[model samples]
Target: MAFQCQRDCYMKEFVTTVVSCCPAELKHEVNGKKETLKGFNVKLQDTILFPEGGGQPDDHGLIADVPVIRVTRQGPEAIHFVASPLAVGQEVQVKVNWERRFDHMQQHSGQHLLTALADTMFGFKTTSWDLGRQRSVIELDTPCMKPAQLQGLEEAVNEKIRAHVPVTVQLLSIDDPAVEKVRSRGLPEDHAGPIRIIDIEGIDANMCCGTHVSNLSHLQVIKLLGIEKGKKNKTNLIFLAGNRVLKYAEKSYSTERAMVSILKTGPDEHVEAVDKLQKSVKLLQKTNLSLLRDMAVLIAKNFENNPQKGNFFSLHKKEGDNEFMNIIANEINTEETLVFLTVGEDKGPGLFLLAGPSRSVAEMGPWVLKMLKGKGAGKNGRFQGKANSLAQRAEVEVFLQQHCKHQTSEEE
Candidate 1:
């Protein structure tokens, strides 16, 4: 779909429209399945579906019971992407998705109210805004925001929502005197069209191009979630409105309940419980490491008396730490003793360490690594690597024993 199409229709329809159409194939993925939608790009005399623009998403609905998946504005005309093709010059019933439309209206109008309130109550100007599906955001020109200030602004905005302030729209030429009175982010550099001003009773009047509810009451409610740090000094305020706020609250409550049950604590004690549990875990890990170190010292003393056993040592265990293995090596004569150790619980790619006289150390790692189909690094008679399979442990031990004996005989 090109943006520069010139066959534009300017008449904007509110409810239904007779439209001419042309067949267009759309290839896209749905739910991870690629499929082709046999549809037509229908150009109507007018359309109720608002085309995506100005940070707001496009409206979706059916055109004569066939789903209109997408709508885009090509120049002045509203292009409806319908499921099946319609004959050229055929008049079709176009129904707007009122539920989705109303939701957008609530969110967009709620944003204007919130933005205006922020500006008036705290002197923060709205830099930009986005209308999302679940929530909306407004970027405020401020370095930081106080929690108390946010609470105050939220309370003030809800008060206006309860006031049921009437929202009015006015279209004025750029040169009109009243245009000067409207609050706008700024006029676009290429803008030549008349300004569309949205007025919220006595609260505010700002120039905007998006759809909005006619009354503040229609917003149901406005919630300021929080602020996110934005570029340099700007703050982006997250918010939700109407049904979305209720939905978010419901999901949050459900998640909190799950967390409480899993933590085995009530909501009031969850934070304290988690902190205490973390401290206990740290203490237990420290104790376990001390035990492993004691075991390493005992094993190393046994090797000191019987250096022959340590000369060609190979130990493969279900769970061992590299630090524990290195501690054992530190107690042995690393210049003469060759040590091959491996550790794993129940899987491939297990941790391994090899150390001995330089010649033996270099030969041991490459042969054992090849047998296990793994990789490693070594220097100064110490090599650390990973084994791909536990089944190769026996083969690695036999190969090391034979090579060590051959190397010993050659030295004699």
Candidate 2:
């Protein structure tokens, strides 16, 4: 009822007197805390700020110097959520955030122009649309479009913008004959009022409630970014309108400059230079892998012939990884001997591995990980895990030695 009253009373005026001000019925969250924000749900006789509706975001601005954070339609009233309470029955100066409002106008209107031309020239009806902050998209019913067709569609839309066609609006009875000429998916089932229609000269006439620019010239330009496959065999067309086009261009140019500096190559040679560097890195990686395998073989042999020391065979490599430790574990797991190998230096924590008969491997796996403040799992006769604090590695070695001694005593 409030939304209906406001819409009916003010129609589409930009500024008006405040009808009333009261506390908002809802609460909101600010920052990380839940606090009751002082919301002034002020209703104006007529205002320019669009309430959030019809897929377009609400306009934000100030009402008599108080920040208007949000706007919503309740029944017939457009409720303005203000920073602080305002006095009822007072005149307020309402200023729309023109930059944002104009940007939406450009994008929304550009979408209409593109959709109309696509339907007319290509028979690709728009299924849905989204007006994003940085870009806009129109999902077409058709599955795809050729590059040449996309290029032509873009040219046609801009041609209309240059032609400066007038975009006019009319409020007509739903039963009016002119309504028959308007293209739409049809009105809401409960709809019972005059239908608003937007006409772009001879190009398009469609039913809509969203705001738009008065003329195509205001759009400045429309640039199609590209298209992608969408839901249910649809194609999504991505584009930017007005200031967003310039913003995107500036961002792209800045990124290219940064890339050129980092790569130390001219723009034309950047691709070739990157490709060569990537190939070289790949070859070097292969060489390193071969060397690591050789090192693992040599390390395993050294420990193999040292003769049994107690029931455990333990070795710690200052520079070792999961792969290297695994290779050593495979080489030295024999005679039921518990092979405990650790690779890493005092520089940081390292990989810790324990491989032996199934029973010992299972027992020491969890114990070593817990003692070293790490975690891992294993099965069969192999167990490998990481050590977060290798400062405790010597302690682990002592524990393993003691465990081996205990087993020998029991056997004897």
Candidate 3:
């Protein structure tokens, strides 16, 4: 059963009687995000809005001035989900969003033109397609499309639109001989009506249920963006048609202007400028690492020169990393002096390291790490890993001092 919108694509308003209105919850997606709409499913005597089917989105409009969120086909009926309920047998005005509906018509018809041209001119068959909010995609059976082939196909499609060819819809009985000649993927199991054939004059005829423009000229113009890899051995051709082409051009110009300001270069040189900037950053990182290593060696030499100060040495550097801490530990003999080092904020999360007499480090490393709300391991005379808190730094130092005194007494 075809809705009024399909019969006459230009129809925007219809007067219909409400057959039934029942509570319904629709779960659907918008811009890749899932949304739930709680409303009433309304069945009308007939609808001017097309339901979602045949790869086209549902029409959104008003049913008796109440916002209609979605319309879906259940068997042969178009069920409208409206924000408010209408009493059964009531007469209401159902209006289509002319702007949105016309956009869909232009795109759907544009796809038909592209598919038909690709088949004859390039020998690439369209396996599937999707009509997105901003752009549309057509999956070709081939693995890829070359620039020349794409340019040829785009030119051929625009030629047809320039010719102002007529687009007409014909409803044929299921048993009609012409039904077998038209292109089709087959019909739904619950479909209970005549077959729909969309004929583009001498171009092609395909079976479809989506709304479309009456003439190819209504498509305005089409722009082929590019191609993307598809599942298995397929190529997806991305395109924009009609009003979408204008929208794309506006956004692209704005982006180019912004990049010109930030890059301090024209659009033609922006890519080369960004490439050079990336190379410079990599060079600076290497120079910084070399400087950090030199600083680490110097700090260790000062500690070694003052041996009479104490056997225990502790230090913290806010911007230091594991490599910096390890360098200091290696410069001094942990067997002679206990070394405790940390990096990052004194009272916040950071890393810690302990290198000293094997027995002392092994006995004390685990508990010290636990007190800082962390977990690590000690092997030989070194313990290191991440710690969540360093607020208990004072207490940990006192514990290490007492442990060092006990070992000294035992040695005496």
Q: How badly does each model clash, as a count of residue pairs?
A: 0, 12, 0
Candidate lDDT scores, in order, read 0.78, 0.81, 0.90
User: What global local distance difference test value does model 3 have?
Assistant: 0.90
Which candidate model has the greater lDDT, 1 or 3?
Answer: 3
| Runs with alpha carbons beyond 4 Å of true place in candidate 3 | 29-37, 293-412
lDDT of 2 by residue, 1-412 (tens): 2232123322332456888988874466677776676677888887777787656778878888888888887655678988788887878778778788778778888989999999999999998899997889999999889999999999999999999999987788877899999888776554545787889999999887667888999889999999999999999999999889989999988988997999998888888988999999999988877888889988777777777444587788786578887787777754567888887875368888888878877788898889878778888877777778778877888898888788778889
Total backbone collisions, model 1: 0
1-412 per-residue lDDT for model 1 (tens digits): 1111111111122434546778888776799998998878887676667777656677777666777888876665678887787666656666667678777777888888988889999999988898886779999999999999999998998898898899987778888999888888786464545677889999999887667778888888888999999887999999998888888889999988998889988888988998999999999999988998888778777877873573677776675788888988888787888888888854466888888899878766777778777788888899887777767777778888888888888888
Q: Candidate 3, after superposition: displacement of residue 234 in Å?
A: 1.4
- The local distance difference test score of model 1 is 0.78
Better of 1 and 3 by TM-score: 3
Off by over 4 Å in 2: 1-42, 188-193, 305-322, 334-354, 367-376, 384-412
Sort by TM-score, top down from the best: 3, 2, 1
- Report the lDDT of model 1 for residue 299: 79
